[model samples]
Target: MSSFLGRGWSFPPRFDPRTKEAVMVADETDIAESLHILFSTNPGERVMLPNYGCDLRRMVFEEANEQTVTEIKELMRKAILFYEPRIVLNRIEAQLVDPLNGKLEIALDYTVRGTNSRHNLVYPFYLHQATHPVRA
Candidate 1:
């Protein structure tokens, strides 16, 4: 457990006034946080690391349909396989929350490589254009 503890530090550390130290998160929480960071980041957005993110954003502007869903799933599968070596992907589900609103919902089921512990994560992304008009 102590060996795993080193890898369980939370992404956004929480302060503990009594100990004057950051609170550590459980192992599952740490893995979840790492996945969130990986999915949220866009390729080329990271400094000097241009190929670091998933390609889901590229299909966001396209119509939400079967083709879009398939593409998104492939992108997710590739990204996770390439970037996250600690987890083995079990399944990926993607769909539009509302075609009119252009919101997409994605769920990923994975197992931690060495431990074989299963975990699932769902993420919502907005793909619609701004409703309000912008003044020049």
Candidate 2:
């Protein structure tokens, strides 16, 4: 977690394969619910709120510790590029595990959607050393 705490974050190129100018985040309802919870927990960080189209602006969130600022900003840029979503919901969930070692972890989930879609797409990711996070 220390490694993740200080590094800049980025996703590889070719994140989306769709050609319609928009891509739904995912088809999972539970993921949507989780994203809702994450958003509700942090409202100020939501730089781009959803609307009716794909021409949405990117958003960035500054972490409390300021250590993951680069990672959070990168998250915003990637969300904009991959989904071109109407909104960018940025959130950080943190918990303390070992006080002696100062081991903590943060989770970031972005809810992005395509135009003319019925459901929202939830792309969730968490950071940890040696384990890849899941996103769609």
Candidate 3:
């Protein structure tokens, strides 16, 4: 039953040094990695599955205020609900890290369906000006 939590290519798609094959991730790591991809990708970014990802980019130009935070939370919920079925999402907290620059941190609380293992994942969402480089 828990095997339904699948195995997939590692995020950033690295290769094994010895075998020169693509690295893979399994179980909870795979799920977490997939979530990272989901949050990073924009909906319609994929040609084959046009709606496969989260649409956080839709609000790229929106102010990182409460309303934008709420909408982003909904986007996360929708993406997880539609694309990932291995876990049940319990709560999502989208907090503004820096509103002026459009940075947000989304915290997710979820449980795996088969074994009831609890997990927490924090996904960082940001826009182009979200951070400032320090100059000494």
Best by lDDT: 3
| Candidate 2: tens digits of C-alpha lDDT, residues 1-136 | 1221122212121334566333233333333443333322333444574432221112122222345534444543444444333435455454444434333343444443432234434333233333223443
Angstrom error of the Cα, residue 35, model 2: value is 8.3
**How does each model score on TM-score?**
0.76, 0.26, 0.87
* Clashes found in each candidate (C-alpha, N, C closer than 3 A): 0, 0, 0
For candidate 1, the per-residue lDDT at 27 reads 65
Candidate 2: clashing pairs of residues: none
Superposed model 2: Cα runs more than 4 Å off: 1-65, 84-128, 133-136
Worst 10 residues of 1 by lDDT: 127-136
lDDT-wise, the better of 2 and 3 is 3
Worst 10 residues of 3 by lDDT: 127-136
User: How displaced is residue 117 in candidate 3, in Å?
Assistant: 0.5
Q: Which pairs clash inside model 1?
A: none
- How many backbone collisions does model 2 have? 0
lDDT of 2: 0.36
